[model samples]
Target: MGDGLLVFDGRCGFCTRSVGWARALDRRGRVEMRPYQEPGVPESIGTDAATCSEAVQWQGRDGVRLEGAAAVNALLDTVSGTRIPSTVYRVTGGLQERVYRWVADHRSRFPGMTPYCESHPAECAS
Candidate 1:
C-alpha cells in the first residue's frame, strides 16, 4: 500500500531492462529498485545474496516479502490500479511461477540482451 522495494540482479541484462520498464510505469514512485550486488543492499532489505540471486525480491511497506512471480505481481499492483495480472497469476495454477523461473534460468540466452554492467558502466562502477 505504501512504498515498496524491488531487489534484483544488477548484472542481469534482462532484469535491468525489465526494471527500467517498471520504473517508467511507476509514475507515482511507489517502488524503489535496488541491485542486490550493491553494498549493504541485501542486508538492508532483510534478504541474503543467495536468495536474491535465485529470484527478484519485493518488500512491501507493510513488511511482507514476495519473490519471483509474486514479486513482479506486487510491483505491477503498485504501478497500475488493476489487479487483473495478479488474478491471472493466481488462477493459473503455478504457471506464472514456472514461466518466471524459466526466464530467470535462461535470461542470458535472450537475443540482444546486454548485462547492465556493460551497458551502464558508470552505474555499476565500484
Candidate 2:
C-alpha cells in the first residue's frame, strides 16, 4: 500500500467531517490522517497550528510532500483512483491557496474552532 499522510485540525468540526469522508472513500486504507495537535508527531511533519492552518499537507514515504489543494487532491487519488478528474477539478494550486487563506482568516465560525488561547481569541488560529 502507498503511504499517504493527512494533516488536519483535531478540534475542527469541518476537519473531522473531511476525515470521515476520507475514511469512507479510502477503501484500500492508503491514507492516514494525523491531527496536527496529536502528540508524538515529528516537528518536521509540522505538528503546529501555523503549518496545519496554512495548508493541508500530504507526506508520503521518503518525505514526498504535497501542500494545499494538492494535498487534498492527493488524498482523493489515494482513496479513489478513478476520481482523478474530480480531484483535479478541486485542487488547483492558486485556488487552493485562496481557500486556505479564507479558512485561516475566519476560522471562528467553524464548529469546534478552539480559540488559540484561553485568554485570547486570536490564539486559536490553528
lDDT of each candidate versus the true structure: 0.84, 0.64
Best-matching candidate per lDDT: 1
After superposition, the stretches of candidate 1 with alpha carbons farther than 4 Å from their true spots are 111-114, 118-126
Give the lDDT of residue 83 in candidate 2: 68
Please, what is the TM-score per model? 0.86, 0.68
Clashes of 2: 2
lDDT of 2 by residue, 1-126 (tens): 257778766656666666777889888888777666555443556455567766667876557777766777777776776667445656566776678668756655676433213223332333
Clashes per candidate (backbone, < 3 Å): 0, 2
Number of the top TM-score candidate: 1
Instruction: Give the least accurate 10-residue stretch of model 2, judged by summed lDDT.
Output: 115-124
- Scored against the true structure, residue 8 in model 1 reaches a CA lDDT of 88
- The window of 10 residues in a row where model 1 has the poorest summed lDDT is 117-126
User: For candidate 1, what is the TM-score?
Assistant: 0.86
